[model samples]
Target: MERMKEDQDQIYYHSGADLESVKDSPFLEKLIKKGYEVLYLTQAIDENMITQLLDYEGTKFMSISKDNFKFGEKDQKEEKEKNKALKKMYKPLTKFLKKKLGDKVSKVRLSNRLSDTVCVLASDQYGYSARMEIIMRAQAFADPDSFGYMTPKSKIMELNAHHPITKEMLRLVESGEDDERAAELGHLVYDTALVASGYVMRDSDYKSYADRMYKWIGESVGVDPSAPIVEEYPEEEKADSEEEKSDGDANLKEASSSSADPASEDHSEDSSEDHDELLYRSRTRVEDEVFMATVSVF
Candidate 1:
C-alpha cells in the first residue's frame, strides 16, 4: 500500500499459485506497463484475507482479475471514450463470439486490462476469482455438483480489440464467409482464456478442445482431418493372393486330366465285359439242366 501513488485510491493485486505465476499474468500486463505498482498475492488464503480486510488506510483493495478493476488514470475519460468507440466498432464480432460460446460465458466485451494478451476471463465484482474457484474446488472434494451449487454463474470473456487475432476474427465475423471457421477459432480462444485464467474445463469441453487442436494440426500439415482411416496392403500380400489363385487353377486342371485319361477308360471297359460273360455262362448252365429233366420225364 505504501508503494501506491498519491493519486491512486485503489490498491491493486492479483492472486495465483506462486510469485512466478502472478508475475507473468496477463492481467498485470497493462498495469505494469502503465507504471502502476501491483501487489502479488500467491497464498491460497490471500484472497479470503483481502475479502475480510477490504482496504488499507483510506484506499480500497481491488482485484485486477475482476471486471470492476480500474487503472485510476487521470485521462480515464479519454480511455472510456476510446473503449466505447471500440465496443461500437466490434459489436458484431462480440455478438458472434457470444453466440458461438453460448452459455459458457456470461458476456463478451472489449478489454481495458489487456495489452500484450489477446483475451482474458474476468469475474464479476462479487464473484469468485479463478484462484478462489480452484481453492474451493480443491476443498469440495472435486465434486462438480457441489461446485455448481456453490457458484452457478459464468465469467465474462474480455477480448483485446487491438490484437491481430481479434482484428482478423472481427473481419471474419463481418464478412460472413467463414462462420464455421470463425466459430471454431472463437471457441478455441475461449478455451485458451479459460486455461490461462486458471479455470478448470469440463471433460466434454476438454475433449472438444483437443479435437479442434488435432484438426488444426492436420490442416497445418496438409492432411484431411475428416478422412477415415483405412488399412493398406503391401506388395507381398498381392503376390501371395496371385500365387494362391494359380495353385487352385493347377489343381483343377490335374483333376480334369485324370478323369480324361485313356488307361482309366480301358480299365472300366474290361471290367464291364468280364461281368457280362460270367452272367451268360450261368444262364446256359440253367437251360441245359432244364432240357435234361424234360427228356427224362418224357
Candidate 2:
C-alpha cells in the first residue's frame, strides 16, 4: 500500500486551459524565450507511462528544472570569453556568498539562462527540483536524510551578470570598508533567491532579514540607524489615535460636500447599478496589471 501510494503520488501531471495561460511559465519561459516547442504532459497517467516506457523512439525524456537541460547550441568562444570575464569580475561576491550561505547552497555561478532577471535558484542535474523537495518536506512520512545517497546536495544560485543589481553587488564587494552592508546584501539576495525558487527558510532567519531590510532602507533614505527601535511607542499610538479622531469631522464635511458633485454621484450610481460588470472589470484590470508587472520584472 505504501509503495502504491508513493507511485500514485509520483504520477503527477498538469494541463493549462489555454496556451496563453502557460505561455511564459517558468518551466517553459526560457525555452519559449529561445524559441522551442515543448511537449507538455497533460494527462495524470502520462508521467507514469513515460517513466515506464523511458523514451519514445530515439528521443529521451528530460525535466525542465534540471541543470543539464539545454535548449540551443553551445556558447561560442567570444560568448565564453565574455562569461569568463564576468565570472572573474564577480568572483569576490560569489566567494563571499558561498561562505556566508555555507551548506544552504551547493555552488554559485554566472547565469546564462537569465536575460533580465537578477538571480535564480537551480538544482544540479541529479538532484530533485526545489518544488519537489518542498513537497517531500511537507509530507508526513518525510525524512531529513531521505535521499542520503545522492551526490548533489543543495541548489545552485545563478546570478545574472548583466543586471544592474548584480553589478552593484560586485561594486559593493570591491569597495573597501563596506563589509557590513555587503554582507547584509548577500543574505538578502540569498533569501530572495530561496523564496523565488519555492523554498521557505526558518522563521528566525526571515525575522532577521526583515530587520536588516528595515535598517538598510532606513539608511538609504537618511534615517538614523542609531535611533531607538521603539522611541515613545505608546505616545506614538496616542498621537495616531488623536489624529484619527480629529479626522472624523473633516470626513463628515467631505461626505456632505461629495453629494453636490455630480461626477462622484454618477460614478457611485453606476458602480451600484452594475456591480457584476464593475467587479469583472476590476478583476480583469488587476489581472492585466499583475501580468504587466511580471513581464517588467521577469
| lDDT, candidates in the order shown | 0.87, 0.66
TM-score of each: 0.75, 0.60
Judged by lDDT against the true structure, how good is candidate 1?
0.87
lDDT of 2 at 36: 48
Give one digit per residue, the lDDT tens place, for model 2 in 3-48.
2222121221222323553343345544445544455554334544
Off by over 4 Å in 1: 73-75, 140-150, 231-298
Candidate 2: where are CA atoms >4 Å away? 1-30, 39-54, 74-81, 147-153, 224-226, 230-298
Candidate 2, RMSD to the unseen true structure:
26.0
Question: What is the lDDT, from 0 to 100, of the residue 218 in candidate 1?
Answer: 96
Q: List the residue pairs that clash in candidate 2.
A: none
Query: Highest lDDT among the candidates is held by which one?
Result: 1
